[model samples]
Target: AQSVAQPEDQVNVAEGNPLTVKCTYSVSGNPYLFWYVQYPNRGLQFLLKYITGDNLVKGSYGFEAEFNKSQTSFHLKKPSALVSDSALYFCAVRDFWSGGYNKLIFGAGTRLAVHP
Candidate 1:
């Protein structure tokens, strides 16, 4: 049972707008999407991963993510938005019951307000 859903708790874009932080997932066999970004006290910063050949997955600062296996979704994009790209955004999968290590099943944090 792998699940992730960031149905927006907050997302406001202004500074050169073009930002989306919405993720939806529910794994059973193959699904490994990830995107993390947190800055306030700074900790979880890894902004991009789709784990199996392209569906448009780029990483780091000017983030990119689009792995839509028929809309099971993995959407995190930033064409412009900055204000230091305000923080707190996460969407994860891959928690194969902790045996494969690197366990992750998160998605309840999306607060990115890049205004001016």
Candidate 2:
């Protein structure tokens, strides 16, 4: 089984400042990690993914994440935050189940607040 943990329930930042949401995971094999953002009452929107290649991967809306294998962590980061960036962020890991199905296990989620 695969599992993920998001230690922070919420992260607050002022507009135009860098923000980070932390995540950690544990999986059997090589991990497939991902990040998604959700607006109020809306489904999650894909942010970025780290399947292979460089440790750092960029994604939609100027968001990026660092995949640290040793630490088993994939933390989301942005250089500058926008007031609109305030949303709920989720960390996920793809798992291959015994039934031959691939599924995503999401973290508890972190709420980001960017005050103007």
Candidate 3:
């Protein structure tokens, strides 16, 4: 089964500092990986995705992620953090056999606390 795990329940970072929210996954064959952010009571905002190609992929709000095939991990990263960036993050994965619905299997979610 394809699955994702976010080891951290929360990450604390001061505004303007680099930040990272770790994520790892398990899947058979190739998997489609994604990162999403959500503010309280709001739907998830797409951050980035790793289909194939470059190991490092950049996305909205200056966010980026590196896909490590060897480790089966896709960790979100940013050069600098913002207080407004504080929110809930989730890592997701979907396998080809799961159909083309983009029906993702997500992690428990990580809270990013960015202090100004």
What is the total number of backbone clashes in candidate 1?
A: 0
Q: What's the residue-level lDDT of 67 in candidate 2?
A: 94
What is candidate 3's TM-score against the reference?
Answer: 0.96
TM-score of 2: 0.95
Local distance difference test, candidate 1: 0.87
Give me the overall lDDT of model 2.
Answer: 0.94
Clashing pairs in 1: none
Q: Which candidate is the best by TM-score?
A: 3
- Which tens-of-lDDT digit does each residue in 46-109 have in candidate 3? 9999999999999999999999999999999999999999999999998657777887889999
- TM-score for each model: 0.34, 0.95, 0.96
Worst 10 residues of 1 by lDDT: 94-103
Give the per-residue lDDT digits (tens) of candidate 2, residues 1-116.
57999999999999999999999999988888999999999999999999899999999999999999999999999999999999999999988463545489999999999999
- The TM-score ranking, best first, is 3, 2, 1
In angstroms, how far off is 19's CA in candidate 2?
Answer: 0.5
lDDT of 2 at 18: 96
User: Residue 91's C-alpha lDDT in candidate 3?
Assistant: 96
**Candidate lDDT (C-alpha), each:** 0.87, 0.94, 0.94
User: Which window of ten consecutive residues has the lowest lDDT sum in model 3?
Assistant: 94-103
